[model samples]
Target chain A: MPKGPGEKRQWQFLERMLLIRRFEETVVKMATDGHFRGHYHLYIGQEGTGVPAIAALKRKDFLATTHRNHGHILARGADPGAGLAEILGRATGLNGGRGGTIHLCEPKLGFLSTSGVVGGCISLAVGGGYACAQRRDGSVTMALFGDGALEEGVSYEALNIAALWHLPVIFMCENNSAGAMGMAKGGYPSLVHASKNLLLIPKSMGIKSVRVDGVDAAAVHAATTRAISLCRSGRGPVFIEAMTPRWAGSDPLWPELATGITDLRMATGGAVPTGKHQAWFEHYDPVLRLARELANGGEESVHRLSALDEATRKRIADAADFALASPLPAPETALNHVFVQEASA
Target chain B: MSKQSYAAALVDALHDAMRSDPRVSIIGGYVLGLGPQRTLTDRLKQDFPDRVFDPPTSEAGNAAVGVGASMAGMRPFVDLGTASFSYLAWSQLTNEAAVAHYMTNGRLTAPVTFHMLHGVRGGGAAQHSQSPHAMLWNAPGLEIVAPSTAADAYGLIRTALASPNPTMLVSHAKLLGIETEVSEKKSAIPFGVADIKRRGRDVTVVATSLMVPYCLTAAEALAKDGIEVELVDPRTLVPLDEKTIIESVSRTGRLVVVDECPLRGGIASEIAATVAERGFKHLKAPIVRVTRPDTPVPFSLPLENFVTPDPEKIAAAVRGALKAG
Candidate 1:
């Protein structure tokens, strides 16, 4: 470990960014391998948005996110293997594999909940922040959503309440210009104006706003640290917009050919990098940016990335193995977990 | 024991639950409604200023907020106002809160209590009145409990607050004014347990929500003839105490599901289907369902009355089931 505080923190950012990158990679692979029995939305290009935002928070702070949450969970210290195992529907997975990709919740790690509904968790963070405000627990909540969520009235409802009450919530929107495939097969260009002008909506509601370059992890961390400071000082209910792009470029179709997937990879087999979007992801990746930044420190940073990459890959592999070996849930226990007592039963 | 209306009981339950747990939050079109209902969250807001809130008339947003708070460790008793209006917030209530626990592999629990006023009251036609529990019940991860009495409301509301499952506590709007004497001591109504409001041998009349009281009335009328009526109230719908219902059906050898929702695939159908599937051999006649017509709740009072499953209609359905037997 590096001795200087700044150096140590910088390395932490690099490690987290890499882990997020790899976790998404493994998830794309798992989806390819048919490990996910349900629908999954990949978080490939959005690592820079979530990793640093979560890094700025304390463990007690709550993170309520949208469906694209793999990056958010990984950034919040969820074991990648466990996360993989979870998506694989194994009992040992993060949500016992029940949440799959879209509805994952790891409350112990302060990852409150994720919803497939676009604007689902925006107002939810407001409620969580309300609890934090009443308790004076010094815990703030972050609502991480994509550009499409802004179109939904829930975001406005959430911001209005958060602002009205001065709740300790940081409304974080990662504008990826993405929409549901059910609605838009390609990216939603109509959402561009909304994404660009999103900061104004929160501002009109009386919540303070800050804009940041989400492509750079350190910049995101610095922005979030400032936001967190403002929140802790009782100047909260802040809105931060990270204008970032998805690494899979414009169309983030799955890698699976049979499932309308394109420009993605399988879990076990490495992708040869065919599509233009894949090449772009390889070239302008945020994790790569952070790694390259860390590598600026010369041999030490180089050696660390080398070791971390190998360890993370092994961790993901072990997770896949564990998930593969884990038993499917018992048919009789289907009634189990309908209620909490039933879970015990 | 003191006499209290169902609405007052709900208000009292809200007060009691909020007092007991600091995490209880109430939000939505949830006005404490009538003067009596106002006593619930109004006082709650005064005491826990930050916890009790009335967000913009946005049910989808409000639903998300409640679920989020519950997920983050708060027991949100959300008054979605009318059950019919829940259609506006269906995506969150159904796709989010309802499916959260099961989808999360049971690691996450949404303990939010959705207090929705259900059934067709005169003038509440169409959007203003609907019993969506049958629709909501189709979802796997939620508990839908409709209480017909003041005691049932108090007990079930308390249970919903204490419960870790996402619960829809549908209190019949018509039952709001109906008063009953209830013990001041807290009533703890466990989910999935059927209450045998009235027991008889010839036929079983399983009713829900306000229909319970009506069925009791019909049971009285049916007693004039040789037909004896057994009445059961499955207070909590999702954790349906099917065992109790099946047993009652086996003894009676006849079953009729009385509900206020639409006839097509509502609670009545679910109950009838459950009994038909599990207790087939016990049936002496085809399982009958006396529910509101598939048509939307009509605006005219006469049309509404004609469509609603009243005591007369229930008696007719029972007689029809008896004739079939």
Candidate 2:
């Protein structure tokens, strides 16, 4: 169902998701081509969750993300070229090529940054929210993490503090079913069970909690809108569990290779393959579903999407060229920036 | 002259820093209460309520918030009620504050001052009491300061507030009420530089924080016995004043390091290793260290005292070094 009184926002949400999807697809291809060297945790299957969650945020609000944070970075309004260039390790990147994909940050845009360590950003976001509340800046902070981060003690501690202090922090959990190779069901008893457990856990700690169907962009957007409104009105620390799935194959594709030949054949065998109770790509591809929905909307929407895809592709290519041309950091420069200099005369 | 305690000296330091730099802010728990050493927050809050923040009982979150404020160009003095509580904030101090500059390759800086109160205080048992200087000293890219005197506490704290790197000032709860004539100047006692508390030629006794007073007492006692001993106070640990330590050891050819931290991989061990490696040829005796045994500080007064390095221990270690010499 469409969210009432925010038709324009729905379109904006779709645009942001499209941007993230196109950008990530381009990044996957670049990584495959060896242009991007470091570990890239693509937010391919989970763009719907991030796009709408970010839509709930004001421009001045702050956010922090985990290693898999390309969607959050884009939603926070970082220049796509700068983000792409950073991931590619270019001088023109957000952190001047110093921080690659795992550490992409745009502080000016209120995106505090990303840390490769799981659940580390949770406390940082709580702190940021506390600072904002102390300053009475009316800005909320969103901490975006994966299901893998829930097990970390720091995340729990952060949530407790945020709740106790009534910090304007939104804990956005992107439950994408897997942490690397471990399935949610195998690692956690069950994703649905874990989600329910988390819901009561936050409420018991005096935090407001919600669960949303992350695959449905509109549902994610509606939950975010409510959470953000409550936070802005001085009634939060809120918890959101976006039950999304990993629609695309994990980046690098090398890890999937180890899953066995049968699985691989089933995954890539057909365009819209339907077998004995085994629905194929048609049921799992997030981008394909989005494209089909847009195509059904009108010929004009399809044309606009194609233009967006072309622009995003060109931007990615240009970023790759820029990154390739940039020089690697000098060995001597390694010791630099360990400490800031005392303010001078 | 009016008498005052060590805690009062720290409050004075906080007051002096706030008077000098408008940007300086203090955040901690029970800082606004009339607890033992009065309250650093109570006095500052009366004077500058906006600057002195009494945060909730969230040590890690508050520390990280202080870090964030520092990143936003504010000089924040974060107080972890006790040294034991600092363990909860290790990740923030080590990961974010310490590594921000290096990770960003000089693009960002977190100039946060963490003030932690530690050391055995009466019957304050295992959970409440712990000397965590060793744990903090192990973390690279952080400036660790432990001042024994009120004057140094005032001076060094002023300097740490102005520093661009993440700094930790571990104050001993036992030393808070001691009074000394602190200078009004806002001068910095440079980090990694050791002070010669007492001059002697027979041997060099290196001490830190609360151990400095014990070493001084030991030096005086040894002086009466005609065993002249020098006392060296290494106010800062990280930028360890290796030059001063080596110079003193080279001249005396004997060394005794008194550290409150446990023996295993403690700051004393680091100092001893540095001297042994650098001043090996000049050494007339093996370097000895007087520190707590490799175990947690206990609750019993006698046991805790025995566990902590004292003047008698330093004096004995000095005599042993002299005998070896």
Q: Considering every candidate listed, which one attains the maximal DockQ?
A: 1
TM-score (all chains, Cα) for each model: 0.88, 0.85
True contacts kept of 1: 0.62
True-vs-predicted CA distance for residue B261, candidate 1, Å: 0.8
lDDT (Cα, tens digit) per residue for candidate 2, span B128-247:
778887887777668889999877887788888988888999887777766655555535677767889989999998887888877888888999989988888888887778889889
Q: lDDT, candidate 2, residue A307?
A: 71
lDDT of each: 0.76, 0.73
Residues A1-345, model 2: lDDT tens digits = 243555456556656766776677667667778886755676766877888788778877888788888888888777888887788777677777778888888877776535666767787787667666665768888889877677667777778878877878888988776433344323222133345356676787979898887767778878988888788878988899887665425623331211111121122222334553233135444444445555454556556556755665576567556666767666666556555652210
Error of 1 at A129 (Å): 2.1
Compared with the true structure, what per-residue lDDT tens digits does model 1 show for residues A203-261? 88778898888777778888888888888778888888887754432343443322223
Q: How many clashes in each candidate?
A: 9, 7
**Index of the highest-TM-score prediction:** 1
Q: What is the lDDT of residue A304 in candidate 1?
A: 71
Model 1: residue A144 alpha-carbon error in angstroms: 2.0
